[model samples]
Target: MTVIVQPTGVSAADVIAVARGDAQVEISPAAVEAMATSRAIVDGIEASGRPVYGVSTGFGALANTSIAPERRAELQHALIRSHAAGIGAPMPREVVRAMMLLRVRSLALGRSGVRPVLAQGLVDLLNHDLTPWVPEHGSLGASGDLAPLAHCAIVLLGEGWVLGKDGSRLSAAEALRTAGLQPLELAAKEGLALINGTDGMLGMLLLAIADASHLFAMADVTTALAIEAMLGSERPFLPELHSIRPHPGQAASAANIHRLLQDSAIMDSHRDDLAHAVQDAYSMRCAPQVAGAARDTLDFVSVVAGRELVSVVDNPVVLPDGRVESTGNFHGAPLGFAADYLAIAASEVGAIAERRVDRLLDVTRSRDLPPFLSPDAGVNSGLMIAQYTAAGIVAENRRLASPASVDSLPTSGMQEDHVSMGWAAAKKLRIVLDNLTSLLAVELLSAVRGLQLRAPLAPSPAGRAAVAAVTPFAGGPGPDVFLAPVLESARAVVSGPELRAAIEEAVGQLR
Candidate 1:
C-alpha cells in the first residue's frame, strides 16, 4: 500500500502502514505545489534582507547573530552537522522510519518554507527503506527532538549513516548512491525545518497508541480467561452492573467478559453455589474497572495523537499571508503527557494481571488447583517462577511509570529551558508496553493451566481456543520442563495475531 502525503495531513493508520508495514509514500501534487508556493515566499524574504530568524540569522541562543549571504549556506550545513550530536545505540528500524515519514508529513504542509525537493528527499528514503541511524538518546523534546532529527537530516545531506534496505549499516552517501538517489542541498530555512519539530516523540506516541489499543483488547481477552480459570463468577460483568457507572470503556469491557464466559461449564458448575461463590478477589471482580480505565486512557491518548497528526510542528511557521513567525508548536508536552498517562494505565493493568497470576498459583486461594498448578506438588515447580517473573516485570513497570514530562532541564544555553522530556517519556513507554506484553503472557499461560486442571468441565469456546493456541508451543499440563521456553512461547502467542484469531474464531469478534 502507498500513503499519499497531503498538505492537510496524514492519518495515524497511514503512519503505521509506512512505519511498520513498509508501505510506499508519495507527496501529493497539491502538497508539492504548496511547498513551491512557500519556497517562493522564503526566497522573497531572503532577497529582502529582513534578517529572518532561521532564514537570515543563527538559531536558538545564537538567534541574534547575523550572517552574510555567502555564509548562509554554510550556516545551514553547520547547523545540521553540529546538532547531529546524538549519542547512544541506534534506534529501532520502525522508529527511525516513523520519524522520517513524520518529518516529510510536516514539510509537505509547506509551512516550513522548504522546496518540494527537500520533502521528496525524505520520501525517497522511505520508499527505498533507507532509515537514518538515529540514536536512542538526545532531544529534550522541547526543541522538537533536535538531535535525533538532525541525525536524520544529516543523512539527507549524505553526511551521516543509514541502515540500508538489507539492514546493513552504511554511510548515507553510499546508501543514497546504491538506491540511485542524490543528496539534498538545503536552501534557506530548510535545515532548521528538518530538525525543528516534535516528530520523534510524536511518532513514538502514535506507534505506542496503536500497540496499546491492541494490548487493551488482548487485556480483556486474558482477563476473561483468568476469570474462568479461577472459577470466578461472571455476575460482576453483568450489563446492569456497569450501566449505572456508564464509562463507555467499562461497559464495553464488562460486555466482552460476559460474552466470553457465556456458555462456560465451569461457570455453570458454580452457578448455584452462592455461599462459596459470593465473591472473588478484587483482581477477579474488578477486572473491568481497571482494564476499562486503561481503555479510557488509550482513548484520550488517541485524541492527542490525532491532533498531532494534523499539526505542522515546525518553528517559525509560514502563514497563509506569507508571514514567518516563531512559535511553540514544536513543544512535546501534549505527547509527553499522553505517553506518560498511557504508561501508568498499562502498568496498573499489568499489576492486576500479576496479582491474578499469583492468585492462580496459590493452592489456598486457587480453590482445588494444585500448588503452582503442578501435577505432583513439591516435585515440580510448575509455574512457580513464572509469577516471580511477572512480579519483577510489574515492579519495573511501576518505576518506569514515573512521568518524564513532569521533569525538565534547561538546554541551548537556557534558550530552550523547561524542555518537555517527551522523548524519554516515549522511550520508557515503549519498554513499559513490551514488559506489559510479557506480563500478560504470564497471566494468560497460568490461567490457561488453571482452567485445564478443571478436568471434565471444559472451558468456554473462547477459553478453549486460547488454550489450544498456546498448547502447541507451551504444551498441556505436565511436569516442568525448561519452563523458560514455555514462557517465551506463551509470550509470542499472546503478542501475536494467532491467539486473537483463534479466540475470535471461537467467539465471534471481541471488543
Candidate 2:
C-alpha cells in the first residue's frame, strides 16, 4: 500500500499504514510545491542576512550567538551531531518509522522552511524500510523530543546508524548507498526543523491509541465471557439501563456486552434465580461502567491524536504572509496529557479485569464453580496463580498510571524550564497497555476455564466461540499442568487478532 503524504496533513490511518504495515510513503506534488515555496522564503531570509533564531543564529540557550554566512551550513550539521546524544536502547523499528514519517509530514507542510530534498530524504528512508537507530532515552518531550528526533535527523545526513530491512544495523551512509540515495546536506533552518517537533511522543501516542482501541473491544468481549462464566445477570447490560446515563461509550459497551449475552443458555438456566441473585458483584455488573469510561478516554485520546496529525509543530515557522516567526507549537503537553489520561483509564480497565479474574477463581464468589476452576481442587491448583499474576500486573499498572506529564525539570540552562515529559508518558503508556493485555489475558484464561467447569449447561454462542478459540492454549477443567506455557499461550491469543475475529464472527463486531 502507498500512503500519499499531503501538504495539508495526514490521517491517523495513514500514520498506522506506514508505521505498522509495509506501506510505502509518497510526497504529494502539492506538498513538494509547498516545500519549494517555503524554501524560497528561507533562501530570501538567508540572502537578507537576517539573524533568525535557527537560520543564522545558534539554538536553545545559545540563541543569542550569531553565525557567519559561510559557517551557517556547518552550524546546521553541528546542531544535528551535537544534539544526537540520546542514551539507552534503540527505539522499536515501528516507532522510528512513525517518527520519520511524521517529521516528513511536518516539513512537507511548508512551515519548517526546509527544501523539498530534505523531506524527500526522510520519505526515501521510509520507502526503503530503513529505520534510524533512535535511542529510547533523552527526550524531555518539550521543545519536541529533541534528542530522539536529532538521532533521526542525523540519519538523513547519512551520519548515524540505521536498522536495515532485515533488522541488521548498518551505517546510515552505507544504507543510503545501498538504496541508491545520497546524504542530504543540512541547509539553514533545515536541521532545526528536522529535529524540533513532537514526532517521537506523537508517534508513540498514535500507536497506543490504535492498540488501546483493539484492547478496549477485547475488554468488552472478555467481560461478556466472564459474566456468563459467573452466571451473572444480563439485565445490567440492558439498553434501558444505559439510556439515562447516555455516555456514548457506556451505551456502546453495554450494547456490545448485551449483544454477546443474547440467548445465553448459562444466563437462561438461572433466569428465575434473580430474586436470590440480587446482584453479581460490581466487578461483573459494572464491567461496562469501567470499560466504558476507558473507551471514552480513548476516544478523547484519538481526538488529540487527530488534531496533532494536522498540527504544524515546529519552531520558527514560515508564515504564508512571508514572515518567519518562532513559536511554541512544538511543546508536547498535549500529547503527554493525553498519554497519561489514557494510561489512568487503561489502568482502571485492567484493575476491573483483575477483579473479575479474582472473582472467577474464588470458591465463594464463583457461584458453585469448583475452586480455581479445577476439577481436582487441591491437587490441581488450577488457575489460582493466574489471579496472582493479574493482581501483580494491575499493581504495576497503577504505578505506571502516575501521570508523567506532571513532573518537569529544567534543561538548556533553564531556557527549557518546564518540559513536558510526554515521551516518558507515551513510553509508560505503551507498557501499561501491554500489561493490560496480559492482565486481560489472565482474566480470559480464568473465565474460559470457569465456563469449561460449567459443563453441560453451555454458554452463549459468543462465549462458546471464545472458549473454543482459547482451547488450544490448555486442557479443559483439568489438574494443573505447566501453567506458564498455558498463561503465555493465552497472552499470545489475547494479543493477536484471531481471538477477536473469531468472537466477532459469531457475535458480530464488538463496539
Candidate 3:
C-alpha cells in the first residue's frame, strides 16, 4: 500500500506501516507547496542580506558569528560533518525510517525553509527502502535531535552511510548514484532546516506509542484469561458499576472483560459456588482500574503524539510571508513526558500480570488447581520457575519505570540547560515493552495450564479459542523445557490478527 504523506494529518498506524516497510510513501501536493513557500522565504532572507540565526549567521552558542555568502556552502557542509557526533550502537532500521518520514513530514509542512528536492529525497529513500544509519545516542532531545538528524542529513550530502535494500551498508554516494539520485547541495538555511527539528524524538516516541497501544489491548486479553484461569468473578466488570464514575478507559476495559468472559461454562458453573467467597483479590477484581489507568495515560499520550506528529517542530520556522522566525519548538519535553507516562503505564500492566501469575502458580493461593499446575508436582516442577522469571521481570520493570523526564543534565555548555532526556525515556520504553511481553507470555502459559486442569469445566468461548490456538505448542505439564519457543508461540497468539479475530468471534457468539 502507498503511504500518503499529508502534513496536517497522519495517524500512528501510518507511521508503523512506513516503519515496517509495508507501505510506499508519497509527498502530498500541499506538502510540496509548503516546501516551495518555505524556500521562497529563505531566498527572500538571503536577498535582503539579513543575518538570521542558522541562515546568514551561525548556530547555538555561535549565533553571533556571521557567514560570508561565498562560504555558505562550506558552512552547511561543515554543519553536517560537525554535528555527526552521535555515538553508541546504530539505531534500528525502522527507527531510521520513522525519523526520515518525520523529517520529511516536518519539511512538507512548509515551515523548515528547506528545498523541495531535499524533502523529495527523503520520500524517495522511504519508497526505495533506503535507510540512513542513525545512532541510538547523542541527542539531548532538545535543539532538534541534532546529532542523529545530522547523520541523516549527511546521507543527503552523499557523505554518510546508508543501508540498501539488500542489507549491505554502502557509501551514501554509491547508494544515491545506484538509485539514480544526485547529492543535495544545501541552500541558505537548508542545513539548519534539515537537522533542526524534533524528528528523532518524535519518530521514536510515535513508534513506542503505537506499540504501547497494541500492548494495552494484549494486556486486556491476557488479564481476562488470567481471571478465568483463577476462576475469578466477573461481577466487578458490570457496566452499571463502571457507569457511575464513567472514565472512558475504565468503562471500555470493563466492557472488554465482560465481553471476553461472557460464554464461559466455568464462570457460569461457579457463579453459585462459594469456594473463595464473594470477591477476588485486588489484582483480579481491580484489573479494570489498573489497566484502565494505563489506558487513561495513553489518552494523554495520544494527544501529545498527535500534536507532535502534525507539528512543525523545527527551529527558525519560515513564515509564508517571507520571514524567518526562530523559536524553541524543537524542545522535546512534550514527547519526553508522554514517553515517561507510557513507561509507567506499561510497568503497571506488568506488575499486575506478575501478581496474577503468582496467584495461579501458588498451591495455597490457587483453588482446586494442582501444585504449580503440574500433574506430578514433585517431579515436573511445572511452571514454578516461570513465575520466578515473571517476578524478576516485574521487579526490573519497576526499575525501568523510573521517569527519565525528571533526570536532566546540562549540555552544549549550559546553553542547553534543562535537557528533556527524552531519548532515555524512549529507550526505557523499549525495555518496558520487553518486560511486558515476557510477563504476558508467562501469564498465557499459566492460564492455559489452569484451563487444562479445569477439564470439562470449559472456559469462556474466547478463552477456549485462545487456549486452542496455543494448544499445539503447549505440551502437557512436563520437565522444565526451553521456554523460548513457548514464549514465541504465545507472542504469536498475542500479536496475530487471526488469533485475536478468533477470540473476538467466539465472544460475539456469547453476546
Question: lDDT per residue, candidate 2, 278-375, as tens digits?
Answer: 87799888989988999999999999999999998999999988899989999999999999999999999999999988888888988888888888
Report how far off residue 189 is in candidate 3 (Å). Answer: 1.0
Q: What is the lDDT of residue 251 in candidate 3?
A: 83
Candidate 3 on 1-511: residue-level lDDT in tens?
Answer: 7777775746777888898755888888887777887788788788788898888888787888999988877888899999998877678888888888888888888888888898888888778667887777888877868898999999888888887556566798888888888888888778887788778777888877777777777777888888888888899999999999878888888888888977788788788876656879999989888888898998898899898877878889887677778888888888888888889998998899889988998888787788888878887788888889889999899998999888888876677787788877887888898788788888888988888788788898878877888779987566667777887887777655666678777665211
- Cand. 1 Cα-lDDT: 0.90
Clashes of each: 0, 0, 2
Whole-structure CA lDDT of model 2? 0.90
Query: Model 3: runs farther than 4 Å from truth?
Result: 7-9, 164-168, 509-511
Clashes of 2: 0
RMSD of each: 1.1, 1.2, 2.0
Error of 2 at 469 (Å): 0.7
Candidate 1 per-residue lDDT over residues 432-502, each given as its tens digit:
99999999999889988988889789899988888787778777788788888888888888778988887
Model 2 poorest ten-residue lDDT run: 161-170
TM-score of 3: 0.96
